[model samples]
Target: MTMELCYNPAAGERGLGDLYLPEHPEHAPVALTIHGGGWSAQDKSSFCGVSQFIASLGWAVFNINYRLTTIAPWPACGDDCLMAAKFLLDGEVPEFAGLDRCKLLICGGSAGGHLALMTGLRLPPNRVAGIISISGIDELTSDFALHSFRYEPFFGGEPTEEKQTEANPLQYLRPDSPPVLLTHWDNDQVVPVESARRFRDRGRALGCRVDYYEYSTEDEGHGIWIPDSKPHRLYPHLETELTRFIESVRPENPPCPTK
Candidate 1:
């Protein structure tokens, strides 16, 4: 495996990303991993483990860092994610030139999960293949979501109802929206499992494909990073499900485009 540093100077100094490109990258699928820190803290390193796991599967992975609430607020984090995806899709980086655009997938936990949804929803249909959100917030309008605390710092104050509606990915589902894989722990103390359930239900209602997996609180816990968390025992299961879903959605032998 080889690694390269990718940054969008236009996005800002903090708008940096690390790309993990595997050998023999012909027609390789890609996974973009985002870290979760309530949108105020944490960095790309938080997802290093998962990124490496995905790359080990003969796929390219891009783990990215974006502006935190302390530096810029609300849409800044969301915008940075979109910029990172755009950077990859535009073939701005040589290391990722072998990526299969039609097989691109976005995966993240916690706050990163939220950004993945927003990014997937906002981007053009042809840009992304699927989404994997672990304990992500679906309804910004609910106080149980990031807007209660994590979101306030970014917004500079409370987001208006309209603004909340705009930020909520659950409210914008369409047939064109990418297929989603949602995994939520029943006992997640931060973001409730109901959020994931709502997203799954709504997506299905809109004729969008959504795969829902719910784990028990006693087994999985809230955060996948927690020590001895259920994630440890379930990593293999989760990865298998994710891989199957990706394979099911991606075209067989879809010729990868090179810049």
Candidate 2:
């Protein structure tokens, strides 16, 4: 199927900018892609090439742009992420036969990964299909408390307690959470290794299907660097795995539905 390309139509260029979609006109599962820029920077189109690549894999891809902190603030960005997902899946979005409600996935890196995990916690277990978090920040609340936190300013100098609870996926555990694939490079310096460990442990404890891939540190640090470029890398494998996940949960032929 071909990928459909469209703007928010409703938001036009006001809500966010340079968002893209695939042209496929069928319910072939959907993946809402978010890009990481420490919450302040980075545009949706920066990851549109990746979204287009995912679209070629027999799935629908929606490149969504949330209100960046540079232009807005913390909760505004987070709320926009949730709002974007709501818009996509509610039949208002014309892409993929109204959001491909049957199969939905959220895949992102770094800050985007944090958003993906947090979004999963807020929504119903079945609202999404699975998560692929590549070097995402899982311990945002803890990081905020630490003096060395890199996203301090972006969070508007420490998000309030309520926002912390909402933004930190580690705060709540859901039993039926969809399968999650987390990738981390142990030696990286930026978003620590503990982030992945905590997420894996909590997810397993909650009875969620969690698979973690740790990359070698021969190269790669601070961000998703060379580790994401291996011959059999997490970044490339995400699309294939996502398709299997979708086929398994296709309602008429759904996988057992997690726990």
Query: lDDT (CA) for every model shown?
Result: 0.75, 0.63
- State TM-scores per candidate: 0.89, 0.78
lDDT of candidate 2 over 183-216, digit per residue (tens): 7777756677788888898889878888877766
What are the per-model C-alpha RMSD values against the true structure?
2.8, 4.7
Off by over 4 Å in 2: 1-14, 17-25, 145-151, 159-163, 222-259
- The top-ranked prediction according to TM-score is 1
Q: How many collisions per candidate? A: 1, 7
Colliding residue pairs in candidate 1: 74-154
Shift of residue 171 alpha carbon in model 1, Å: 2.4
Q: Please list the residue runs of candidate 1 whose C-alpha ends up more than 4 Å from where it truly belongs after superposition.
A: 10-13, 143-147, 219-223, 226-234, 256-259
lDDT of 1 at 74: 79
Give the clashing pairs for model 2: 3-22, 3-23, 4-21, 4-22, 4-23, 4-24, 248-255
| For model 1, the run of ten residues with the poorest summed lDDT | 225-234
Error of 2 at 252 (Å): 5.5
lDDT of 1 by residue, 1-259 (tens): 6465656676565688878776657778777888888888988877777777677767778889988888888788898888887776665566766567565688887888899998888888666778888788865555345437565675878766777787888877898788889987778878877888888888998899899888764444354554654322236656677777767666347654433
